[model samples]
Target chain A: MPPTAALSIRDLKFRYPPGADDAPAESGEGVGGWIVDIPAFDLARGEQALLTAGSGAGKSTLLSLIAGLLDPDPSHGAGTIEVAGTNLLALHGAARDLFRGRSIGMIFQTFNLLHGFSALENVMAALMFSAIPPREHRARALALLERLGIARPNADPDRLSVGQQQRVAVARAVACGPALVLADEPTASLDPENSANAMDLIQSVCRESGAALLCVSHDPSMAERFTRRVGLRELSAAPAAVGG
Target chain B: MAMTDFQIVVRSLTARRFSTVTTIITVAVAVALMLTLLGMKDAARRAFDRGSGNMHLVVSRDASPLVAILNSVFYANPPRAPLSYAQFRQLRDELPVEWAIPTQQGDSFRGLPVTATEPEFFTRLRPDPDREWRFAVGRVFRADFEVVVGAGAARQTGLRVGDQIYVTHGTGTVAALAESAGARVGEGAAIAHIHKEFPFTIVGILEPTGGPHDRVLFVNLHSSWIMHAHDRRLASDPSVKTTGAADVTDADRLITAVLLRLLTRPGQDVTAVEPVVFDQLRRAGGFTVAKPAQEIQRLFAIVGGIHQIFVGMAGVVLLSSGIAIMLALHNSMEQRRRQIAVLRVLGASRGRVFGLMVTESAVIGLLGALAGVGVAVVGQQVVASIMRGQLGLVIEPTVVPAILLGVVAATVALAAVAGLVPGVMAYRTSVLRSLKPLG
Candidate 1:
């Protein structure tokens, strides 16, 4: 009855290699490691949530599943994961990849900007797979960088400071106007000032773009920034917390 | 952020500048080798195709056709038994001839063959009918002791018009014999160098003909008789004398070969009647008949065989270049894993990643091929100059554009194939695994 969820997951379970503990690894048994088990989770359109976890609590694994980087293990897992109405678990391989590129924006912890590209080119490249017309890619990228307070949009990534680089990464993430923004430990390397600035910049940009934010972090202090918060230990269905 | 496939390729290659340059150079060398070899074959064929168009027949004493062509046209190899002056007269009087000019040799001015012939030789000889020999400097030889230098000979000797040059009798094999004969009895058996009493003056320099004709010194046949008599051995015979160009008896006159041009009757095809006349000359038994054109054909066959072998070697080089591209891409795939994973997360399909790798190789191949062609063009200019100066064989520095385009296309295609292994490797890369920190 409420606004449709931007992301929804239910009865989700995954284990690497896939089976019970009794069978041999070759037979897809003990080789399996419990990665994710979520009974239910949802993010309504335009809502922001922060997901926190310890080092080994499968924060990345869960992000990967939602991004369609990894498919849920069919035999040892059962689940439905949907983003913007497309069932993530139902798609496979390139279909999932296209959907991710088209509908989701991802920002990683280390500010993974292509080293050879300029700040503006990095953003434009993201829009290459989007529905944006090629002629407008330049203008859109310039506007995004200008809005993010990047003075040198055409400067190479390495030439920029860490704060500038992180801003470029955030600009590239939202370049395609994706419905969901997934930032994984986006401020892990920043000082207090830079971290706070990066977080403020990311949330404001996502909100303006009307994208729901599902940010992953190992730092519990980050939980205070978001209205909704959940832990990987609770979501992964593990009794004991794993060190991040 | 999603980078386009092309931007990714350019950035990746530019990042490894040294490797990319090496790959491009490898490709360039292979392409240049191939194009040069091809250009050589084509140039050789063109040179021989127009080798001796005016003198289709060489009538001389019995000898191998190849040897006769080499001696008469190229001034190479030893002198054959001189064709009798009587035979020259007979052909002049009886045959339906358009023109017959005799060439006499066995003398040299600074290692260049000195041919004694009538002035008609210059006026009548046309290697290509559209191109006639004109004086680059002065006029043709007019007097008995005057000579005309060919373009190549003049360039090599640095001789200009009005330079007096002494001629030595029998410069090649007979130089020693002539020198020994000229030695005085009291000289203690040391051979004396004989130079004619009257030195010939250079009267003209001929323009380049791009053939063997461009490498000789031409004088009136009378000057040869005057030089031959200077040898002490020939002075005693009384047969050698300083006769005018118009006043020479059969006994005093001698020639090496007679170049014939048969007359074509109206409404009659010279090509059709040529064989019949050739058979008559063969059966007549007084003259040895040879077609320089046919001899050149045999030479082409030998040259063509060598050309094929060299081309095969060039092909091997190109193949190795393709392999080098493959190895370069494959080796870098491991390092590029994180980059590829990042692209996948940005909506690049495995196919897109695969295509990016292949396209990268193709770009390299294209660059290499273009650079190689440029090298070939420049290299040809140098080689052609050497060929003109040394061999008097002009090789055009140009190649067929179609063939060049084909080579470029082939190079790019081979490079794309080279990228396949690396493309597949990137396609199968595990995005999740590569993103994990290595142990």
Candidate 2:
């Protein structure tokens, strides 16, 4: 029998409305011009996986779908995304948001640390929605910032170097001890040396917390760092990708 | 412990100091005006009430009730035709008069009205039947040339017990203007010059009453009569008797008005006395009766119309300040879009975002209102000073807690409403587009 997957996506299909004003045109797998079609994807507990895709290949959309930030179209889409035994697609609205906050963490390319908050405060902000006790929030946040090698935990994010800011983002993402951490090209803006360092820090932190890591990157150097590599074209290919 | 959302709000406001201060000042000015207008309305009504006193009726020459009341009680407005001193005596003898005080106007000292009456004026008159006038210092006039100054008059002139001031026989403004203009041949006008020959010493200073009495000078009736009679005696003969107060004997002594307080048995209805007194004055032909309370109410009706206009203008100012708050939040929201999306990604629900915005506006409004109440109190005092100096109308600005509380509640409600549109828009902001990477 297969090991239980910490993150799973099966028989998924999604389509963008034709010429919709706010829609970004995604032309990949054309199952009646569906924007996304994937089948049988899984990440074992504490596994690290990398996904590579060119522009408009539905990389960001897939990340959004897994994060429960976007709702799948019921008419053309039929799928279940389960993260840590909870089916994300089954939840709706605020409930989905809460599950995402408690069980899933996201890292962005821009190192989206709140400008007004310090390095420690940015991590503490994530714990506010978690089940962590209020008394432990500051101590936990301080400990994480120290572990991430941030020299100035109380320094404002705007004053931090690019590499330090990325580390702070990583600390924030894993602060809640979420079951899965999604990284959307987190090192896109960093140099090769800093990029390698950022990836190592994210992977090491996830491993220590026993959280699964799914990262999307265009940089070829990142492919060797992950235990598994998958192509967007492979995930979007026809028939069997939709359980046919 | 987790940092409260309020801490974030305060940080955001202080980070943008200019907008916060401008919004507060806008709200402060609007609130000050609202309090000033409302305070003036209340104080004006009270001043009229204090001046009404125990006397219910005023007897004067036939004229409008407003003219009669203003001339007699306030010693303001143009002097009405005089009622004979003999006629006042006749009414005192025939009517159920407990006491009658005859007052002659048409004279002033340093812009304060000079009222001439017998010594009974102070001893008998009471603001309420239970209370008589109290003096702050010294004693009432005993000698004919001695005078008692009201609290306001003393404050304005800085006069003490020994300071002597000459009364202008006609009106202070007209006499000063004519003397400055250097042309006056009228006999009545010369009376002001004649009175300068005899100056009266200020012997007493009355306590502050917040009434028209606080702005007037009180003197013996014989002193006024002697001054005017001495004008004629000097004009006719070079030598006239000016030895004592008795030399000013009554011949054609006419007074401006008489304030009446009727005698009644303990169980008798005092209100019933007014109609009989009115009828007696009506039968006496040349005289008319005016009720101070009723006439002052009419005065307020006219003044109240002006008050409503000012209140409407103040409401517009307050409403604009609410708009200023709305604009401030809305403009900041544009800069804060990504920050809001970040909060949502961290687990804040849409409702939480909405609440944060509303609370920000409420904080601004509450702070503005508190500052406004303080500004209003100071503004009202300035207004009171001006009214006393220019109009001889005494109005004390007193804080009414209920009104201030109402202002605070209204301001908060206004701020909440102002923030509603922006808050709802923020609640609807799509988290997907905002969080998407360069991909």
Candidate 3:
């Protein structure tokens, strides 16, 4: 099966703040910030992979790239890329959105559940964006939350503990049962006890959904649970290579 | 996105309770104002048209509007310069007229009978030719001594049939006519036969025409002639002779004005010759001529102008409300940008995303306008009592659908403007960044 690469990235480079010297005399966004460069990256289906690098290494970029967040790596300096048999490089704006909506589920390091919705509402809202039938949304959302061990559907994250919020976020990602789940620092805020619960809940949910997992984190200890571990340096070059 | 669109809209509105209600109420108030103004205009038009029922010509060399309306049409006051009865007779023989019931005024019940004339003087003065009036009770005046009471006269005086009352010999009396119990026409005032000194019975009552006829008392032409003949009747008989009916033998006798009639044809019938003939007759009779239809059109213009003023005022209100909707929509754009971005990334097409914002705005505006009309209807009804009672202005809250159409169309258009801004904003944001955490 050639390891079923769920996401394949080619050489990509980008300038973050549009241009270096375009900043005017003094409205102060502090002149220029940084740049990101990447050679190649790939993630296989149903496999668990971890990304470890320092703070500014763009570890998050790799997850964004695999999840189809950033545009299809426009530089073409790398090579052809594929995800789940669909060529990522050959998609346009609308097609890319549909492709991502159907094939990828993303979990941010920080839980970005809507402030206006309850935990169940937040999960249900994610289902709304999909092409799923509206009548089927409730059942799919509740079942996914139940599988991830969300005991109460009405609880908003503000009322929940840090570990519980991550469960809701994870539940949302796999709510529609996608082919791949990408998490960025899923257990970063947890203590030892909460961390273990979050890791178990997220990894188990992704596996149960039959999705490959790509979790990005700087902490090396979190790698023990995954089948594979690769540093930003090992993927390509240090500092010059960016994952986010 | 489907027929469930309304359901989604309703649920979405209910979900955000206060904002939805306020917006709806705003639109409703505007519609209400427009509706009320339209209804009032209809009422005013009805009243004016009624007051000027066709009495087309006032015959004079030159007559003012007040003189033409009152003396010639209404028969309220006597003509200032009375041509000899011989002159009125001469004109009648010459003109082509539908009908002219000669009229006399300026006498009173004690204080009320400012109108003095024969009963048939009004028979030919039909307001609506199809529906002529007759007495509702008692009998019409048959003798010189008998008097027929109009509905207004009956109601105001508490008068009935078989009652005897006398007219006070004066104009514009200050005291109540009934206060003088002996000679004053009181509760028992009856229809008297003209040309007689003896009392007769009040035979019948006229139907309410919502006009000046309501205030009249009827007598035969002989009664006024007999009153004028009082000087000749003194030695002949101390008691006035009561002739129950007109001395049909004297149909060709003297009258203060002439009564004439010409045949009227139905449908597309132009009586252009009548006006010219009427003009020649007025010149021959030493008077002037006026056409009732032309006079009615003039009245209508005045009424129409007043209605236009009110509608214009309501339009101003509608305009401000439209501007208000636009402002509200524009203000919501920045806050709604994230929502738009999220919808687009959710596989919503650009048009679909734009449509949502626009639809919401339209919903708000349309609801408001419809609600405004409802408010106006109830408001008009509330004030209807005062309107009818004080000014005789009938205010009917007619359900005019065209007005509602205007409200819906105008408000929806405004709401679209509201939606346009946010849609553009959503179209501009980066979909990828919208999914990103706000760092």
Candidate 4:
């Protein structure tokens, strides 16, 4: 009762279908049949955790699973993934999409900002699926971009510098004011200084919004900034890492 | 504010402006071609129908009924054979006809066909039902050498009321006749095979009737007879210096065709007794009795195959454009997988993605079809001008709004159907795989 868990995972198991080599596997985990086998995991509300893993360690795959982009392989085992006190696995189709969009925000290393959209528009796109009134979307998006030190919210994301683009992506992720935020190697493409700045911006934004943060990275140095740290090898019961 | 689905579709199309515009133009060209063919065909049929006028039957010595109507009603060609004055009298007396007007052709003024008939021809004949022939200037020819010019003829030749014009013997242009005859007469060498001795004064100009009649010059039958008799006299003895109307006798009087309106019972449709009169005239023999309406229908039936072939060709073009739309969108899908995946990741359902693709295609088609309608309208004027100049057949601008709307709606539906393949490609896009950065 002290603190509600923003994201709770229990007895989660996922395996790639045989010959499903669409994505590169790390450490021969997909070939060995169990990419993810976690017994239990939880992040308290407003908590920030850094999950470190080597390359191809299924870090992105785990992020995808929590975001409802990919489903856990139920053939191996049934699992429960609860986000904001709602069972994410129970939702289907558009309901699942709405739940993910409203309750979770994700940032990628590549800064997956929608092309052909301005920085403000990328953030507004997140709010499009939220419960927020459409009339207030523009002002909210502009305020968020300004808060992130984006001088020109109308500028195309592609025209922005690498550091600025990441900040824009960070804005998009938290635009909906989701309860939980996920980062899959969010600073992998940045220089050391830019990476530190991106991490600081993301963490500060999450703290301001009272949102929990789970950032996955192969870089060992990322653990120094987080009060909570978990290793992929310790979290996943797979014989090897998901891919690396 | 969040952009609507329509706004998103528009933005996506604008991002690939080259392909979108190319596809729209391809669709526009196909729609224009199809609508133009349809419009011209409808106009031609109406012109033919209007040319028939109120005539129940056209009796001529042509080979067939359709030929008789074309030569007598449309002036498609000058009549080769002439019916004697005695035969015209006999037909007027014996046939169950209300008004029998005899018309003689084979004369021309400045390349326009010249038709000579009685004054009753102007008063009794109508260019269209419920529309009487109205004079634009002066009055109908009442004297022997007086003439009435049609609206189109007056405009083309610049002949006005009281202007004198020498009528030529054949349908050839003055230049062509001069080139053939090597004879130069008149101030500008304008006299070529023209019966210069008998200069007819234009006494009247008729308003446009929107039919082949608009391009004709009308003269009295007595004037034509007198001119021909003088030609015969001059041919017999090249020294014959003068000839007058007194030289024309009953033996020399001839007319090419007789336009007949049958005597119908009170309140009875002219078509009701048309077949009976047609059968009776055919049985008597010696003359071609053609119902102008029936002949027009037959002409349409004969040309219907060619019309269908053109329509089929246009449909093929439309189908090819649809395929172009499909290929254009499908090819773009290959490069747009990541974008589609991103949309899905942003909470756009698969159905939403599918709908977006189809809506984009339909928008392109709607725009293209609207543009095509505009092109067809301008194209119709050019086509109508050509037909008027070359065939002397006036084509009314016949762009029916219902037909246009139907074509536009069909094109949009066709484009939507074309988009289905690409929409499916987008719907099946994997968010997880596509989110990975491409090498």
**Candidate that scores best on DockQ:** 2
Q: What are the lDDT scores of the predictions, listed in order?
A: 0.79, 0.80, 0.60, 0.84
- Model 2 earns a TM-score of 0.91
Error of 2 at A212 (Å): 2.1
B14-34: candidate 2 lDDT, tens digit per residue: 766898899988888888888
Per-residue lDDT of A148-214 in model 3, one digit per residue for the tens? 7778877867898777788888877786667777777777767778888888888888877788888
DockQ for candidate 1, C-alpha atoms: 0.38
Please give the ranking of all candidate structures by lDDT, highest first, separated by commas.
4, 2, 1, 3
Q: State, as a TM-score between 0 and 1, how close model 1 is to the true structure.
A: 0.88
Arranged by TM-score with the best first, the candidates are 4, 2, 1, 3
Q: State the TM-score of candidate 4 restricted to chain B.
A: 0.93
| DockQ, cand. 2 | 0.49
Worst 10 residues of 3 chain A by lDDT: A22-31
Docking band of candidate 3? incorrect
TM agreement with the true structure for every prediction:
0.88, 0.91, 0.69, 0.92
Reference contacts preserved by each model: 0.47, 0.40, 0.13, 0.44
Off by over 4 Å in 2: A1-4, A18-31, A150-154, A238-244, B128-131, B178-194, B235-252, B264-270, B436-438
lDDT of 4 by residue, A33-131 (tens): 666677678888888998876666676778778888778887766687889888888888889888888889988879888778888888888888889
Query: Which regions of candidate 4 fall more than 4 Å away from where they truly are?
Result: A1-3, A25-27, A30-32, A237-244, B172-192, B266-273
- Which wins on lDDT, candidate 3 or candidate 4? 4
Q: For residues A107-163, what per-residue lDDT tens digits would candidate 1 score against the true structure?
A: 988777765778988888788878888888899999999999999998998999999
- lDDT tens digits, residue span B283-402, model 1: 998677788788888887877888899999999999999999999888888778878887888888999999999999999999999999999998888888887766667677787898
Candidate 1's docking class is acceptable
DockQ of each: 0.38, 0.49, 0.20, 0.48
